[model samples]
Target chain A: MMSFSLIVGFFLLWEILCIALNVSDLILPRPSEIIVTLVTRFPVLWPHILQTLYSTLTGFVLGVIIGVSIGVLIGTSRVAYGVAYPLLVGFSSIPKVAVVPIFVLWFGSGTTPAILTAMVICVFPIVVNIATGLATTEPDLEDVLKTLGASKREILWNVGLPRTMPYFFASLKVAITLSFVGAVLSETVASNRGIGNVMMTASSNFQVSLVFAGLIVLALMGVALYAFFSFLESRVTGWATRGNDIAIT
Target chain B: MSMTSDISAPARPTAALQPATQPASRSNPVHPRPAIELQDASVVFGSGDKVVTALSPTTLRMARGDFLALVGPSGCGKSTILRLASNLIQPSSGIVLLGGREPAAKELRIGMAFQNPTMLPWLTIEKNVMLPLKIVEPFKRTFQQDKKGAYRDRVHALLAQVGLQDFAGHFPWQLSGGMLQRANLCRALIHDPDLLLLDEPFGALDQFTREELWQILQDLYLDRKPTVLLVTHDLREAGFLARRICVMSARPGRIISDKAVTMPQPRDIGVIYTPAFVEMTQGLRELIAQIRK
Candidate 1:
């Protein structure tokens, strides 16, 4: 309740500050004007919103699959970790925006470039988090399973994977937001679709409210997906953060 | 962490006691083999200057249905012995065998509990207790069918015996330390393993809670006679629970003294106060003190 009220107060403050300062729409559009643009342009904007959402989801899913596979390899094997970790670190440090044009050059401007960008941008965090989760598994737990005569595969399935849920979900929230950034970056660089493309066209035409409207849409999508992932994290890993109704043994 | 050791029990009415001898007949053909044997088995962690001898040239054996306790000061490799028997680590030298085969033999089923309750946090106490049934054989083969019928009932019965029947649906975190340890024992016994290895399972509990768990353990042992190898620090605990107690020295640990507990079976918690029991623990403590020097 407090956070909801604080957010409302923040927007109210922004609206008052803009109107009192008499800021030009081109210089800074009011939240009221942006909200009006969002409502008025909903019909024209729907397809672009769908386009960004589709590309981001596709890329995010692909990133997670590849990340988990590499993570298991790196987490379980010393050689793989030593070899891949440096390369991954270097790749992740590079500005993802710089890579978007190269993706466009290869894919020739459209959803493919946006998707490839999102996939590459989001993969690093998932890989790092999953590997950390797998590597930090309790040795005592492993010994318990080993004494049960459980096969390596069985131990990995029963213990290693479940133990990694918290780390996996944490990375998903981070990577989901990054996926949006990547998709939009690629759309702005080359594609003629998505909210990023809409913003670019609006700004060039000096449709400041439409540009602000695009930003609002992106912010809303980011918050919505982040909320979705938080819900998922709670459902899957509720045990990790269960209410302190009883003291731990 | 399979928390719960064999060392803490000092309870049970002597009336229900049975002789530790007279091996119960199992279904196996041919002569029965000792459940575990370590011949000159030694473990050295790391190599070169970093090499620390965890156990030095130790030979130990346990017959089927034997309840043996290994006791010593901290760093005495008592836990290493348990780990060796469980095949969690290979000895740096010599032989370790379970049922006359290598300790890692596929057919061998072992149950283990440590000093820390190692229940998977994601699973409810009931599911955690039933973990072995999903892995070990015969039961593993028909687990889905049996889980709903005989297997589920067995878990409930064990839970009821340990006074945890109502908490079956609860997670491990909902229980206290003592309660989780009871559930730990149920998990260890659920699959009817041939060997049950316990490493200081009660080492973390209060004196009162530890004694209460002793009775639960005593009942479990009398009902199901799996060969047990317990590693613990408390001599009274060692004396109370096992038919035999082996005391080891400090680091580079090796069993220096092996003594048989003469107290009759199903000893009550009062046994810890009896003259004979007190004398026995005193003697074991003195032996350990002498060897430490």
Candidate 2:
């Protein structure tokens, strides 16, 4: 309820400031104007919204799978970590937008470039977080399991993976957001679908309110995905935080 | 249940008694195979100029069901012996065997507990105790079928022995240090391993709590009869729990003295106050003190 009121107050303030300043619609559209445009353009914008959502979701899911796989590889083996870490760091440093054009060059625009961009951009955070989680598994705990004749695979399954949940979930939140950025960035540069493409066209046509509407939609989607991952994190890793209640008391 | 009553000593005295007459020795030719045999085992860490010998060449043996305590000052490699026995680390030199064979070659069931309870925070105490059954063989093959039946009963019985029966559903974080350590003991014993290794398992508890756990551990030992290797600094603890105590010298540690506790078996915490117990502990203390110098 508190967060709901805070959101309302923020929009109300934005609305009041636009009216009081008598700002031109082209310069900065009011929250009311953006909402009006979003509602009026709903029919025309619906396909674009669906396209962006589909691409982003596809990219996000693919990115997570690849990221977690690489993360586990680096986490469990010192040789893999040593060989892959520097290469991953170097790749992650390259501007993802620069890589989108190369993806476009290969995939020839449309949804493929956007999906590939999203997948590549979000993989780094997931890998780093997963490796860290695996590396941090308690040696004493491992030894207890080892002396029971637990094979390496058994130790990983019972202790290593469950212990990695908190770190994995934290990375998901960040990775999900980055996935959206990659998808939208790719769409604006190379595609004729998605919110990014729609916003680009609206801005060019001086349909400022429509562009503002697209921004709001993207923000809402980003928030929704982040909240989804946060829910999962709490469900799977509740043990990590629930212990604090006893400590505080 | 109240903690004291829950962990009260058993009514039967004979359960705790071993023959009391037969002392253990490396040269006990009558025994076909010692449960654990370290033939001149040594451990050295690092290399070149940074070299440090953690354990000097040492020979030791324990017959089946022997409870031996390794005691000395800090860094005397008492823990190294436990690690070697458990096969967590191989000796840098010499042979380390279980039942007269290399540890890896045998399907030896082993259980170990450290000073830190090290419970996985995610699991309830009951599930934490059952971890070994899910991984160790024979148990692992039938674990799914027996999880709700025989395995559950075994876990409950072990928990009841340590006064943690009521806290089986609780997570490790909800329990006190003493309670968690008791659960740790339960986890170690749940697999009914052939070997049990404990490293300062009660050293962190308060004096009263520590004494209470000693009795709890005593009860468990009497019931299971696994070969036990305990590493502790407290001589009284050694005297109360071990059939024999081995004292070692500092740094590149080697066994300087080995003495058997010939007192009557299955002794209670009260035995720590007896003249015989005091004399045995004092003798070990002086041996350690002399070696330290």
Candidate 3:
């Protein structure tokens, strides 16, 4: 309740400042004007929001699947970790925005480039987090399982995977935000549909309030997706964070 | 590393003379096989210039259903002995046999509990205790198909034995350290293993909790007489629990002494204060002191 009021307070202060200055709407729109644009331009904004959402979600899901698989492969074997880690680090270091042009050249301006960008951008963190989680299984715990004649596969399935849950979920929260960033960056560069394109078109047309509205919708979607994953993290891997008790019941 | 006394070479003559007095039942005609045996087994970690001999060639044997404790200073490779018996690590030299056969060839079931209490945090106490059943075979083959709740009933009964029945639904992190250790014990024993290996299983607990767990371990051992090998530094704990205690020398570790405790079974915690128990522990303490020096 306190946080919600503080956010509202900040917006109100901004609105008051905008009105008192009698700022040009083109230069900086009031919060009320942005809200009005959001309400009135809902139909115009809806399709772009959906396009961005579709690209982000599809890319995010695919990224996670491939990331987890590769992470496990590297995590389970020292040889694989040695072989792949440097390569992954190098790949992740290349600014993903630089790849957007290459993606645009290949797929042209549509959802494909945005999605491919999101997948390429978002996969690194998931892979690193999951691999670290698996690699860090306590030696004593491994000894305990090994003494029972548990095969490596069994140990991986029973202990390694469960131990990786907290890391995997943590990466999901990070990856979701990155996915949005990737989608938006690609859309701005080469795509014709998503909120990024909408914002770009609106700014060019001098519809500053509508551009702000596009940003607000994107922020709202990011927050909602982040919150959903956070909820899922607490639910599915609660044991990992059990003693922390930072989350409200 | 500084070289310690070659304890095994010096102690061999004494060890050979002593085994004759290790009770007739151990050599009884009907049951000739020792539960676990390490014959001249040595473990050397790494190779070339970095090579470190963890356990010197050591031979030891435990009779079926015997409770033996290996007590030594830290890094004396007492744990290596347990690991060798469990086949978790292969001996660099010589043979380690369980039930008079190579460990790999034998259908040996081993239950092990460690100092950390190593309960999987994700699993509820009940599920954690039931873990061995889901892994070790014959049980693994039928655990899911036994839809009659037999496995669950067994888990509940085991939890009840450890005074953790109420916490069966609780996650490991929700439980206190002592409670988690008790759950660890239940998990180790759940499969009804032929041999039980404990590596400082109660070393982490406070004095009161450790003593309480000693009683729990004693009762469990009495109820189901499984051959037990416990590795610990606590002489009093060794005196109170094991029928036989093997004291090892410092690293490049080898058994220096294997003394039998004649204090009798179902011995109470009060036994630690008795003259005989004190003598036993005192003997071990002096031996360790000499080795450390």
Go through the candidates in order and give each one's C-alpha lDDT: 0.87, 0.88, 0.87
Tens-digit lDDT track for model 2 on A1-249?
678899999999989999999989999999988999999998999999889888888998999999999999999999999999999999999999899989998999999999999999999999999999999999998998888878999999899999999999999999999999999999999999999999999999999999999999999999999999988888899898984555321
Cα misplacement distance, residue B215 of candidate 3 (Å) = 1.8
For every prediction, compared with the true complex, DockQ reads 0.77, 0.83, 0.70
Query: Whose DockQ is greatest here?
Result: 2
Best-to-worst lDDT order: 2, 3, 1
Q: Which stretches of candidate 2 lie over 4 Å from their true place?
A: A243-249, B1-31
TM-score of 1: 0.93
- Name every residue pair that clashes in candidate 3: none
* Pick by TM-score: 1 or 2, better one: 2
Residue runs of model 3 more than 4 Å from their true location after superposition: A246-249, B1-31, B146-148
Tens-digit lDDT track for model 1 on B1-293? 12244434554343322333333224234426678878899999998799899999998867777789899989989999999988889999999989889976654679999999899999999989998998888788988888878888989998999999999999999999999999999999999988889999999999988888877887789899888998988887888799878889888999877666667777677778756666677777888888778
Candidate 2 per-residue C-alpha lDDT over B1-293 given as tens digits, one digit per residue, 9 for 90 to 100: 32343234443332222333333544556655888988999999899999999999999878888888899999999999999999999999999989888988754688999999999999999999999999887799999999999999989988987878899899889999999999999999898888899999998999989988888888789888988999999888888889887888998899877766766676766666655556667777887888889
TM-score of chain B of 1: 0.89
Compared with the true structure, model 2 gives a TM-score of 0.94
lDDT of 1: 0.87
Q: TM-score per candidate, in order?
A: 0.93, 0.94, 0.92
Candidate 2 predicts chain B with a TM-score of 0.90
Q: Per-residue lDDT tens digits of candidate 3, residues A1-249?
A: 877999999999999998898899999899999999999989988999999999999999989998999999999899999999999999999999899999988889889999999998889999999999999988777777888888899899889999999999999999999999999999998978999999999999999999999989999999999999999999999887767856553
